[model samples]
Target: MKGRTIVLDHIDDREAAALMVDGKLEDFLIVGDAPAPGTIYRARADRPVKGQGGMFLTTPDGPAFLRQVKGLSPGALMLVQVSGYAEPGKALPVTDRVLFKSRFAIVTPDAPGLNISRSIRDEDERDRLLEIAHECMDGSSYGLILRSSCAGEDAGEIAEDINAMLAHADQVINDPETEPELLLEGDGPHVLAWRDWTDPAEVVTQAGGFDTHGVLDALDVARGVSEPLPGGGHLYIQPTRALIAVDVNTGADTSLAAGTKANFACAKALARALRVRGLGGQITVDLAPMPKKDRRGFESALRAALKADPIETTMAGWTPLGHFELQRKRARIPLSEVLK
Candidate 1:
């Protein structure tokens, strides 16, 4: 079997700025702008329709809503804008509330658009909500992402991060009172996570580099100033893409040695490599089968050897062409980069 080359394209610019976890080929992006990223929007009511209203209260007309969100696309994300409700015929508040509806939702393709049945009496407030919806659809809302990075994140932390962004955005909009000079800007943690996911090797930065302390701090890794290498760039351990294909080989002399010994040797080495490198995904090993007398015993021994390794592996019986297939756990990075 031959080694496979992976390819990734169509990356949005926001993804490019993120720190990579995999060095080989994984690509990802934050849903919005830098600095204050990842905002969550919610409306005052889940169902705003009332009987005898005469207005089409379920959802907006297709053509009209599309025109309203012209900047947004069919399958883009939508974080419904949220606000505090007032008594009937009362004025709406200047600020809003955010209720988590399972983080963010992947905007689906629909004709009339997903029915955000929430309604408001004030036209300005409704217009602002529409503005947020359009921004989400256009991929220009706050820089939010649903990621593996947030796997164990608690609700409080996610809310804090989100609230910080909304407050900052509000500050910018109300600069008249605060007398803003430099606008506050930054991306969400997802940008850094996406970058980490793509980079296969450790992220290396030179001594005296900008934000060195902050970067390492966010990652919760120790900081050490090392001798600078010839070229300057960030170092990372993970690859960009999740897919990997490895070709297993047996050297010529090894095959000339006792055939069973050679098969066992190859499997042992491959197993060790998979363990140390954290190799993952489907693995296919092409082999020179052991002599008929030694085949079954060799397989049993090989399977036993892989048992205690870190990654999970399952050996599919050999094919007529003598190639063996194994599906290993998905690795964040490839073995070559890990070993390097």
Candidate 2:
């Protein structure tokens, strides 16, 4: 798994920026000339709004809310991780549980434990990684999660990364600064995409400007237009306030074989579209009619395609009307909202 190229550019839209991976648009970020997600700040808890169930925290960036304030008190100083940018008239979402992500591991400062990605389903491999995690993280008051990229990695390399992250976490924690300010800045989406998705060795190239031809082309594709698939079929994706709806049109066809192939192609395209666009919540895909015998196979293909997505997703079986239902975890604001 070689790392893909990462292209960063400022989009013409003042409200948005673009992160392209492997020459394709991967994310639309609402930078708004402010710090992006993953930034770390040392904040002081302000007065708690009793009815809101959360306390306002004053940070260098601005005021933010700690949704779950179990052990926090007013004026308490603590490290907070910025989860996302602040919405209009809303405070930024901050968390005390911080995670430092590397290519093959995640370091948790607040939670001290060892875990593995559920995607690594092999019993023997899981046990082996657990042993490695314990060995590398022993005596450290931090948590380590072995990412899927650690599947075939050398144990020594994994240990090295764990040690480095642990050391970095220690540096941040040991600092005695009492001011509410930024302690660390998170990597932008382009860097994060490479760390999470691409191989470590992949070369990343950035475009000089947002108006470059490559970026414009990628943005055009990401604008959520109908995508043509192989064999003269297409996928029509529509995202509304409620949920996303996809229509799989096989076009005017004479043979069942062509239609089935088109369905398969459409399924792949739909999965990619949903992931790239970061469209979450409920989703329904209307597929072309097929025989009862072929339905199982088509469903299996669709499920398999979606499994590759980084976010948590589940297929909710078919509706009575024959549309396939899916639910994905909403990690952030949707592309539609960000673009606006």
Candidate 3:
């Protein structure tokens, strides 16, 4: 019920991982029916959409859409990777900029450089990592990125991870297939948990860890539309076909500052809820009515909350009618859709 606890478990026999912070589910991941992000494919080019600057490629699973694609004629073969989940009945979203990502290193093809994560500010450690990079990446044209997890990690382990990723990249890049084929399957939830959840924490690998660690209860709460806020306020999160709507309500506390207080709580609670539920796309917030001057504070609080989140999101500024808007990447499928 305290600190970080990672629960590796299963739901309906599919792999799932949940992160609990102080007894509350902060993040979660589960296997979905669609092809997972990071799946590599050698796809043949199909017809291009004249107006959209994209092409529908043929893949083993289904049609995949790649945006910003140019200079490739029909029947040409190229490698692509799934960027994220697609909406129901839509083509799977993919990108040509493929990356080989692992726990300690990421290999970038067609990108030449050796770099370290900026979070590791220790110069001595940076030098050590750079030396390891040079040693492992010598004579290689591809780029390498040393992840922040490499900081304070075992030198031999880091080098070994780098080498392993490089070797895999070589194997994948050298394939000479012309037709559409699945090169590598994306990582499952358990593997993603181990790769991304590198921070020190209590790891629960036994079966039924979700129930034992309170993840199931927390998920039940998250599944509902109403989310409780601090000091008796509440938020209702609902996903319409167009966008996600967040309504903030200040309970019987009609005192001064109640609106601002509820609005601030909405920022944090809404972010956590969306993150845990894997909800993304356009978001419009119906904030509790507050003074014009206090809007700046609310925006600042919202910005700070979103900055801490891992997903790529951008604030689209407040609308003319005082509605705050955000655009989030579809990095994961909606929990409601996946569960059903």
lDDT of each: 0.35, 0.73, 0.90
Residues 1-340 of candidate 3 have per-residue lDDT tens digits of 6899999999888899998888888889999999999999999888899999999999999999999887989888889999998888999999999899999999998798999999999999999999999999999999999999999999999999998889888988998766789998898999998889888989999999999999988888778888889999998899988999999999888988898899989877777889887889999999998998988888888889988887888999899999999999888778897675
> Quick one: ranking by lDDT, best first?
3, 2, 1
Ranking by TM-score: 3, 2, 1
- Model 1 misplacement above 4 A: 1-257, 335-340
- Model 2 TM-score, all chains together: 0.69
Candidate with the greatest lDDT versus the true structure: 3
Per residue, candidate 2 scores C-alpha lDDT tens digits across 107-197 of 9987878999998999998999999999888888888899988887888988888887787788788888878888778765555655665
Candidate 1 residues 1-340, lDDT tens each?
A: 1222112211222222223222212222222221122132221222212342211111110110111222333333233221212122322221122222223222222122422323234555444444444544453343333322233345455444445444554454434432112233223334434323422334333432213323223222211111111122111122224333333333344435444555566555555444333345565554554566666776787788777453567777676776666766532233232122
Off by over 4 Å in 3: none
lDDT score at residue 104, model 2, on the 0-100 scale = 79
Please give the clash total of every predicted structure, in order: 50, 1, 0
- What C-alpha lDDT, on a 0 to 100 scale, does residue 311 get in candidate 3? 83
Which wins on lDDT, candidate 1 or candidate 3? 3
